[model samples]
Target: MTTEKLVSEIRKKHSFLCVGLDVDLDKIPSFLLNEEDPIFSFNKAIIDATHQFAVAYKPNTAFYEAYGIQGWKSLEKTIKYLNENYPEVFTIADAKRGDIGNTSSRYAKAFFEDLGFDSVTVAPYMGKDSVEPFLNFKDKHTILLALTSNEGAFDFQTKKVEDDEVYKHVLKTSKNWKNSENLMYVIGATKAEYLAEVRNIVPKSFLLVPGVGAQGGSLTEVCKYGMAENIGLLINSSRGIIYASQEANFAEVAAKQAEKMQLEMKTILDGIH
Candidate 1:
């Protein structure tokens, strides 16, 4: 989707919520295990329940990859369902993929062309050549990893490098590449303090933030520091929402959780809109 279209949807819905489908087989309701495709069944219900509350759906590729080919098929079906049913809702493959130019091009095609995701998360460790390929796709986005939520992020992202933090450089350098206007950043909600700097570097670019509900990140702090004029934030909640209950009413509970977040987003957007 184009950046303008995405921002329009957020404004129309008064929300920038991105529900993460990080489905774990072990955690899902056991009754679903009997279904032909339990993972897809779970996802279908969650999407149906929460679609009105969210502007995006992000499926972490690892969750499906671990289940082998069958898992991958479930992912395909899940994304296809969203694209066909809710074309305005953005879709992201949280794959965190980046490699050499040629490899990145193929990865781009895989997610945007083959799978039909509106965007994909990419590791910026490999630098411009790796990320630019994904940005080249028309109307598709390349969400580069910046300040992450994990504890291990301190191992490198926060380290000073020539008078600047490493992630700071990653964000700044990434904008210089071709079609960088289509680029976005993954700034973990846990690192809300650094968002001011990240924002200064890419003021208009969207940010896909994780670690809100389950990881204890402050949504208020993230919005206060990270929000742009367009409300460029897609706060994600996986376990907290999707796994709100393990019973047959799982999807209902998940929808309620998502509704809570969407209401918060609406209030935030109200001030600026």
Candidate 2:
């Protein structure tokens, strides 16, 4: 989807919530395990229940990759279902695949053309050549991992390089890349404190923020420093919402969790207006 359309959907829904589909078979209800495609079944239920409250859905690649070919089929079916039934909802392939130029081009095509995801998460460690290929696609997005929400991020992202921080350098350098206007960033909610610094570098760029709920990141702090005129944030929640319950009423429980976040988002958007 176009960035304008994405912003429009957020306005219409009063939300910028992106529900993460980090489905693990062990975590889902035991009953679902009996289904022919338990993963897809669980995803469908959650998507149906929470679609109204969320503007996006991100399926982390590792969860499906663990199950091998069968898992991949489930992931394919999930995306196909969303494309057919709810095209308005943005889809993200949370596949942090980045490599050399040629390899990166294939990775970009696989997600953008083959899988039909609106965006793909890309690691920027390989520098601009590895990431620019993904940005070349029209109407597609390359969400570069910046200050991620993980303990290890401190190892490099926060380390000072020259006069500025490493992640700050990443943010500034990204603007010089090809087709960077289509670029979004992954700024972990755990790194919410650095948002003001990030904003000075790319004020209007959208940020795919993970680390809410389960990671104990403050939603209010994220918006306070990260929000742009377009409400440029896609706050993500995974197990906290999808696996809220492991029983037959899992979908209903997931919906309740999503509604809670959406209500908070509504209040934030109201303040913006």
Candidate 3:
């Protein structure tokens, strides 16, 4: 999907919420195991229940990769279902993949062509060469990791490189890469304080923010500093929504969790308007 379309969906839905489909089999209700494909079954329910309240859905690749071939199949089914049923909902493959130029191209093809995700998260450690390959794909976004939500982010991201933080450099320098307009970023809501600096560096670029509910990141603080004129924030809530309940009524409970976030987002958007 184009960035314009994504922005339109956010406006139409009155939300910038991105539901994280980070499905953990152990955490899901055991009843789903009886289904032919438990992972896909679980994801379908979540998507059906929450799609109305969200403009995006992100499925972290590690969760599926851990389950091997079956996991991959489940992921394929999940994406196919989304593309076929809810094309307006932006899809993100939270793969965090980056490699040599040639390999990165393959990764881009896998997510953008084969699986048909609208965007994929990428790591920036390898520099421009690793990231440009993914950015080269037209209409497909490469969301680079900037300031993450994890505690380890301080190990390098916040480290001063000359006068500015390293992640600031990543944000600034990445703009010069090929097809940089297609670049988005991952700025953890836990690092909300850094968002003002982030916006100053790339005012229009979209930010895929994780670490809200489950990680206790303040949604209001993130919006106060991070929100752009276009509302360029995809606030993702995974465990907090998807695992709201593990009972038979899991999907219903998930919908309520998603609705809660969407209502908050609508209020924020209203204030922005």
Candidate 4:
């Protein structure tokens, strides 16, 4: 999806909510386990329930990968369902895959072409060559991991690499890559204070922010510091929304949670729109 399309969706819905489909069998309702593809079953319901309030759906690949071959099938079906049913809503394969240049090319093709995700998350630790391949895909986004929500992020991301933090250099150096325009970033809402510096570097790029709901990140603080003029923030809430209920009406309950966030986002967007 083009950046313009994503922005347009956000404006139309008065929301920039990206519901993270981080499904866990251990946590999902017991009854769903009887279904042939429980993962896809759960995802389809969530997408149906939350599409009105969400502009994007992100399925963290780990959730599917854990189920092995069946898991892979579930992921494929889930993406297909989203593309066919909710074409307007953005899809993200939160795969976090990055490797050598050639390997990265295959990864790009797998997610962008075969599976048809609008975007995929990539780790930038291997540097420019590893990431440029994904950037080569026009309109498909490469969301590079920046300041993350985990405590271990302090171990590397915030450390001084000479005069600046490592993530600052990641943001700065990445701008000169091949199709840098395709780059978006993953900034953790838990580290909202660092967003000011992040914006200073990539003022106009979209940020896929996690840690807002389940992880206790402040949505208000993230918007205050990181929001672009176009409202370039996809605030993700995984467990807080999808796992809101474990009963027969799970999807209905999930919709309510998503709408709650959407209403909050609507109020924020109202200020500038």
Q: Candidates ranked by lDDT, best first? A: 2, 3, 4, 1
* Poorly placed runs, candidate 1 (over 4 Å): none
Q: Per-residue lDDT for 1-273 in model 2, tens only?
A: 999999999999999999999999999999999999999999999999999999999999999999999999999999999999999999999999999999999999999999999999999899999999999999999999989999999999999999888999999999999899999999999868898889999999999999988998999999999999988999999989998998899999999999999999999999878
The stretch of ten residues in a row with the least summed lDDT in candidate 3 is 188-197
- Residue-wise lDDT of candidate 4 within 1-273, one digit each (tens)? 899999999999999999999989988888999998889899999999899999999999998889899999999999999999999999999999999999999999999999999999999999999999999998999999988998999999999897899999899999999999999999999989889999999999999999997888988899999999988899999999999999999999999999999999999888766
Q: Which pairs clash (backbone N, Cα, C closer than 3 Å) in model 3?
A: none
Whichever of 1 and 2 has more TM-score, that candidate is: 2
Q: Worst ten-residue run, lDDT, model 4? A: 264-273
lDDT, candidate 1, at 21: 96
Q: Candidates 2 and 4: which is better by lDDT?
A: 2
- lDDT (CA) per prediction: 0.92, 0.95, 0.95, 0.94
Comparison by lDDT, 1 against 4, better one: 4
Question: Per-residue error at 134 for model 1, in Å?
Answer: 0.8
Q: What residue pairs clash in candidate 1, if any at all?
A: none
TM-score of 1: 0.98
Ten residues in sequence with the least summed lDDT for candidate 1: 264-273
> Per-prediction count of colliding residue pairs?
0, 0, 0, 0
On the 0 to 100 scale, the lDDT of residue 64 in model 4 is 89
